[model samples]
Every structure is written in C-alpha cells, then in structure tokens.
Target: METEDMNTDRVRHVLTSLMILSFLIFGGLSAIILITDTPLTTSSVSLPFAFLFVSAMTLIVTGQIDERPKLTKKYLRQWILVCVFMVLVAALAFTLA
Candidate 1:
C-alpha cells in the first residue's frame, strides 16, 4: 500500500511539474511574439524547440525533488499533448491580437 501511494505521489509531482513547465513555455513564446516583429512561421516553428528545452529543464529540476524517476511513455505522451495545446493557445493569442 505504501508503494502504491509513493507511485501516485511521484506521478502527481511529475504532472504538476509538466503543467508548470508548459505554462512557462507558453508565456515565453507569447512574450517573444508580442515583443518582436518576427514572422508567424518563425514564431510557430520555435515553439516546439522551446517546449523541448523547457521540458528537459523541468525534468532536471523536478528530478532533484525525489528519487530520479524514469520518464515512462505515459509521461512523454502527456508532455507532448501539453506542448501541442500550449502552442495552439499561443497561436490563437497571436492571431487574435
């Protein structure tokens, strides 16, 4: 039972870290878009790169919080989905502005 609880806690921590990282990625991209006169394609193309970098950094930072957890496929999938969602939101914000 304790092992199960620990697994759950680890999952929660990973998810929370991912969520915060996603927000940071979105905010960073939005700031760049808003501040610069870059073309939309350039900004859009940069989102994935930013996501990759920030996600890696998030994992590194969060890993220190607990035993370094192996990133399972489930976590990878969730992070990808979050990245896609954040990119869509950033694009929409730029479009609407």
Candidate 2:
C-alpha cells in the first residue's frame, strides 16, 4: 500500500539521519577526548547518554514531520521506551565503570 511505503520511506530517512548524527556527535566527542588527554573510559561512560539524547531528539523531530499523527505518536512512544532502556543501561555502565 502507498501508506505503508510512505511510512517505510520516512522510517528509512529517520534512521539515516540518526546514523549520520550519531557519527558526527560521537566522532567529535572522541576527538575532543583525544585532544584533551581524557581517558577512554570517560568516553565509554558517556556514549550511552549521548546515544539516548541523540536518538530521542531525532525521533521527536521525525515525529513532527510525519503527517499521520497516530503513527507518529506510536513511534514516539516506542522510541521513549527504547530511550528509557538506554538510560538504565547507561546508569548500569556508569556504576560499573
């Protein structure tokens, strides 16, 4: 169906954007850490939080662009659950680190 195709296309676009944004953000942070002589462990600690923040923002923006409100809301809710899991994992990592 055309609606399904449109949803798939939008999801692909969102994923592509998420990947690019993740790379840029993580790459920049790594570079900064390298330059400042910060420990690799610090980056390890921050990585999850960075991903959580980035993905949430990306999803919010993507949801706004979606013409179907119900679908967007559903997607956003799923992403929120994912982000919460990421945060829990991040917290565990932080404690273990």
Task: Assess candidate 2 and give its TM-score to the true structure.
Answer: 0.54
Best by lDDT: 2
Off by over 4 Å in 1: 42-97
Which residue pairs come into collision in candidate 1?
Answer: none
**What's model 1's lDDT at 31?**
75
- Report the C-alpha lDDT of model 2 over 1-97, residue by residue, as the tens digit: 7897777577759666875787677677677767888766843646745664766566565656466644765766766676677767777776777
Q: Cα lDDT of all candidates, in order?
A: 0.61, 0.66
